[model samples]
Target: MTFLKISKAAVIGAGSWGSVLANVLVKNGLDIKIWTRESKQVTELNEQHTNHHYLPGLKYDERLVATDDLAAAVNGRQVILLVVPTVAIRSVSQKIGKILQTSNERPLIVHASKGLELGTHKRISEIIAEEIPEANRAGIVALSGPSHAEEVARQDITLITAASADVAAAKTVQKMFMNDFFRIYTNQDIIGVELGAAFKNIIALGAGALNGLGYGDDAKAALMTRGLAEISRLGVAMGAKPQTFIGLSGVGDLIVTCTSVHSRNWRAGNQLGQGVPLADVIKNMGMVIEGITTNKAAYELAQQRQIEMPITQAIYQVLYQGCDIKQAIANLMQREGRSE
Candidate 1:
């Protein structure tokens, strides 16, 4: 199918990922607007092409406008990228939906956030569907992979998948953001893409905990491999395509998240492993460490789906149940031998 042309794009969050994505969109010759809730941030972005609060070191394009007004951001746009935290996605989508419902033009919605809703256990796309009706939801897509906001903001070479049931919408987003530095591949399995993106953070925390305990590369490798297994098992059980777990959003993302210092989830787990309290860790991080909530959510989902996810369970106990980090590592090590 011929892709719909995406000339103007609105990013519905001014966080690191949103800013980076907006920059990429602008680089691809699309007019971009970055929406933030804070009026001061809008003013700051307008004056200085940098988002000091979330992404301090990077300077955004002068052409990218930042605004606090959601309606103005989404109105008359060809694409809307949702980059807010998982918990805030529903509220953001609801407001966007109301605005789009009143507008004459409806932009294709693309989600960049990567976490399942805690209470509803719905993916970001699912929440968008619930908030926006079927007709509006038809244009929804999810963009995810191993790409980090830090690297993407720096215009580093990165690849990601834009998945949607609607191939036309997926291709629209692919064409909207694909550039020399940023490559986008289209996939139809939105469920697998979203699940792989969300669940990898949980395993990354486990990998960080191993590193915190001064475990060697062998231990880290084992945790990472087993973690992928658990992720694949749960993802397949949850109706995701089995091969997606091995793709960019799955093992590829998990490796980057677990190994990179840029990963807030890994950093949080590292702190926890180093004997820091969860409250202290969070206070120090000063950002959304997705793994904390994802760990709990994954644990719940595993129970509901009857999937065995030992790494997630271990991290959940350490974070929420006050289980000792050392003991958690020990418990994971003591599990019975099984086939790889």
Candidate 2:
């Protein structure tokens, strides 16, 4: 079957990632529309070409339009990028589904959000499939990577993955965002890519906790390595291609999330380790710390699947069950020795 070419694109959710993605599309010469829940942000983007609330000091291209109306944003679009937080994806998709049902044009959907739904434990793509019909699911894709919005907005060189069961859809998205500084690779392992993207944030939190405790590179490195192992194990069990974990969406993303100062999850974990309450940390964060929610979801998934993910379990305890960070670290360190 021939795939549709994507020229006009709409980005749902005008958060940092959504704005950066819309900017990149506009750079590639596509007419881009950004949808936001906040009417004030829409006004700012329309008037100033700046998303002052989330990504300050960055000017968007004049070709980019921002709107609070979902139908206005999605109508006549060939591609839609979902960048809302995982928790909000369901409600947002439901809205999009209603809007899309009214339009004759069927746009390819791509999700850039990274996290598993907490109670349902659904991947963003899975949630999309459930909300949108089979016809729409055929056009679904996921783009993930080690990219941080701050760096991507600055047009720094970044690598990312575009994964879909539909090759044409993947290629369409790959071409939509591919630029000199932003390179995208295509992969068929959607589950692996999604899992890697979701789980890396949890490990980043662990790394940040170690940093807060004044631990050196040795400890952080160990946590990162073991964290990847745990993620890979679960991914493998879930039928993900093993090699995908070694690629940009996996190890590369894991490194960046765990080490980058711009990581909200890392920052939240650092505050937690510094003796701040989770509520206080999240309150001060003023942004979605996906790792905190993902930790809970991953822990539940591991238990359901009978997968041994000690780090995820530890993070779950610390974040939810009132487990102390020091005790969590000691528990991880004292796990029974095994051959690597």
Candidate 3:
């Protein structure tokens, strides 16, 4: 399929991931503007060429501008990348939808955010579809995998997946973002891709908690392996292809988020295991730990669907119900044994 010609793009959210992705587009020779809620961040990016809060010491290209105006960012851009946190997806998409209401432009809508919506358990794409009308929407694509903003900013080799119901749309994103160090793969199962990206964070929290408790390689390996089983079970129940869980958004993302120091979810779990309160961990981290909220959503989803996700249930209990960390592990260990 022939890809749409994209010369310019708008990236929503000025967080670490948004900044890195906007810079990537600029490096690809596309004019890109980033929308941030903070006016100070706009000045910092436009004048100083840096988002010191997120990507410290990393300079952005001159062509990459930052704006506080939503319309200014979304008005003429051919592509809009929603890089905001999952919690903000609906609000941001509604704002963009209002702007696109008066126009017939169908710009490609690409979302890089993970995590299911609270209360509704809706995916990011579903949230976007709820807010944006079909006429104003060109296509919705999910750009997911293990790629981190910090690593991508330094020109590290990053691999990602672009998933869409429309193959051409996925290919367009793949073409626009691929470089010598950054690679893109296309997948048709948006359900599996998004679920894999979101569910792995829950397991990563468990991994971090185990590490904080000084559990060695055996425990960590068991947690990860069993975590994949539960994640795959839930994803398959929700209409995702089984193979998708083994790909980048699945086991691949699970590994990085579970083991890496850069993972806020893992870090938060580690803090909790080290005797810190959940509230204190979130407050001290100074960043969004997606796993906390995602844990609630995933646990509820599993319950509603009658799926067995012991790790998710334990994590949720620890976070919301004030279950003791050590006791939680004991409960998990005491569960009935089953074949792998």
Candidate 4:
């Protein structure tokens, strides 16, 4: 199929991932507008051309502009990328929906955020669809995988996936963002892709906790591998294809998020394992650690699905039940043996 033409684009959320994707589009010669709730970010992007807080010391292209004008930034754009946190998806999409209500143009809506919504346990795409009018969107897409905004800011070679049931919509994003340093593969498994991306963060926290506890490489490896199994089990139960868990959005993302220093989720987990209060860990990080919230959501999801997720349960205990970290580890190690 011929890919959709995307000349004008608006990226909602001037966050690290949002900024990186906006910069990539600008490099590809697309006119892009980045929207942030903060007026300071607008000045920094327009005058300084940098988001120092998120991508420290990394300069952005002059062509990329940040705005607090949500209506102006979103109206008449061919593409609107939602890169906000999962929690903000609904509100942001509602704002976009209001702006889209005034126009007939249907922009291809895409999201780079990972994690399931807290109360509803909805996927980011599902939340977007709920708020945005169907007639105002060409199609919705989820862009996720192993790519981190910090690494992408430095032009690191990053591989990620763009998923949509609408093949043309996915291809449009793949063409718009794919470049030498960043490559995007197209996938039709939105369920698997979103789940893999969300579930991995939960595991990364566990992996980081192990690291913080001074566990050796063997322990981390065991956590990651077994964590993948737990993720796949619940993913399958949730109607995701089993194989998608082994693909770029699954094991690939798990490896990067669990081990990479740039992972806020991992860092947050590390702090938690070091005996820092969860609130303090979040406050000190100065960024959203998706896994922290995702852990709660995943724990609830596992129960709803009646799936066996000992790792998730253990981690949940440590975070919510005030279970000691050492006890959590000991409990995990003492579980009944099962076939691999």
Superposition error at 339 for model 3 (Å): 0.7
Model 4 pairs whose backbones collide: none
lDDT of 4 by residue, 88-118 (tens): 9899899889888887667889999999999
TM-score of 3: 0.98
Among these predictions, the greatest lDDT belongs to: 3
- Per-candidate Cα RMSD to the true structure, in Å, reads 1.2, 1.1, 1.0, 1.1
User: What residue pairs clash in candidate 3, if any at all?
Assistant: none
Worst 10 residues of 4 by lDDT: 1-10
Q: What ranking emerges by lDDT with the best candidate at the front?
A: 3, 4, 2, 1
lDDT of all predictions, in order shown? 0.87, 0.90, 0.92, 0.91
Per-candidate TM equals: 0.97, 0.98, 0.98, 0.98
In the range 219-262, model 3's lDDT, one tens digit per residue, is 98999999999989999999999999999999999999999888
- Residues 150-199, candidate 1: write the lDDT tens digits: 88887789988999988988888888877888888899999999999999
| Cα deviation of 255, candidate 2, in Å | 0.5
Q: Which 10 successive residues of model 3 have the least lDDT summed?
A: 1-10
